[model samples]
Every structure is written in C-alpha cells, then in structure tokens.
Target: MHEVSICEALLDQLTSLAAQQGWPRLRRVWVRLGLLSGVVPDALEFAFAAMATGTPAEGAELLLENEPGHFDCAVCGELELERMDFTCPQCGGALQLLRAGRDLWLSGVEPMPS
Candidate 1:
C-alpha cells in the first residue's frame, strides 16, 4: 500500500539525482530497510518492478540491506537486536528501543557510465 508511494518517491529521487549528476542510466540502488520501519521488502520490490517499466531505472538492481534495531539495556549498555527481539540475553533485562530501525532510506546509487 504505502510501499507504492515510497517506491514512487524513490523513483522521483532517483530521477532527480540522475538529472543532477548527468547520469543516463541507473545501474543499481542500495537501500537500507530498517527492522521496524513497517515496510515489507517484497512489496517494495514488487512496486519497484512494476513502476520502473520504461523509466531510467528500467534495468537497475534494487539491493536491500536489512538494518537491525538497537536497544539499550540498563545492564548491557547497548545491544543490537533483530525485529521483535527486545530481551537482553546477557542480563535478562528489558531493552529500551533505540532509533536504529525506524527508517527506510536510500543509501547509495550506482549509475551507468555515459
């Protein structure tokens, strides 16, 4: 649902970047998908595939990197935990959620050389 909008926004950004950088074709897009960003990877990929037809990103590869959430346990200082895993194994303490996993962002873009 919202992934479509998100993909559309990504495409818009890619287009703008290509124009600004004078790149003719988009070769690859590297995206970091945060663990708790509430975005479905499959849906995002599907949206990209469907929307990229006849666009500059026609043959681009969408590389998705899963970014895990971070938590701060009073006893453990800081810890990296995957989605829904909020318990500290070291000291059996509940972790306070951090801001490491709440964004879906474009990390980098590789363009085809002219």
Candidate 2:
C-alpha cells in the first residue's frame, strides 16, 4: 500500500537527520498524523517495521499524534469542527476546509550516538 512508500520516505528523512547530527542509531520517532490524513495507524506501523529491517531505526518506536480536521463557513463566518465531510452544520453553507486532515509530519526524533 501507500503506507509502505510513506514509511520509506520517513526512514529516508530520519536517516538524513541522523547523519547530519552524526548519530549512530534512532531510538524513537514521533509523528503527527491528521485524523483525515487517510492513513491507517496500524498499517503505517506495520510498514515502518517492515521497512526498518536492518536500518538504524530497526527497533525504533513510532509514536503517532492525531490532529482533527477543521472547517470555516464563508457565509456564516463560523468555524466548525469537522470529523469527516466539508459541510457546515450550523449555517448549512458550503464549508471551506481551513485545515484539511492531510498532514503526515515528523514532530521529533530521538537518536543514539555510536
């Protein structure tokens, strides 16, 4: 799945960071995932484990923090908490996604020196 590609990308980033800092190993990785980011946590974990084999992050723990989606209504000037779709419940107006839940970010990383 796409999670595999995502995991590979994450590992690349981690490796680059570790190299930049002259770190020998990665201990943990904290990721911020949007709720509507269309990524399954379990799947991502699996992908990470699979891709990390023999890598610096082989046993690194992947911590995920979820962020909810938010929308703003143009007609009513109301900000709405959106769990799924882009419809404003308060004013029945077309909602504009202020922050669409489509972020996969590396928040922090713990590295171990050689």
Q: So what's the TM-score on candidate 2?
A: 0.74
TM-score of each: 0.85, 0.74
Q: lDDT for each of the candidates?
A: 0.86, 0.82
Per-residue lDDT of 1-114 in model 1, one digit per residue for the tens?
A: 989999999999888888898888899999998887888889999999899887778789999998877789998798886676667878988888876767789999999877
Tell me the deviation in Å of residue 27 in model 1: 1.0
> Which ranges of candidate 2 are over 4 A from the true structure?
72-97
Worst 10 residues of 2 by lDDT: 78-87
Best by TM-score: 1
How many steric clashes does model 2 contain?
0
Compose the digit string of candidate 2's lDDT tens values, residues 4-106: 8889899999888888988778988899887667888999999998888877788899998877666778877746463665677887778877766686999
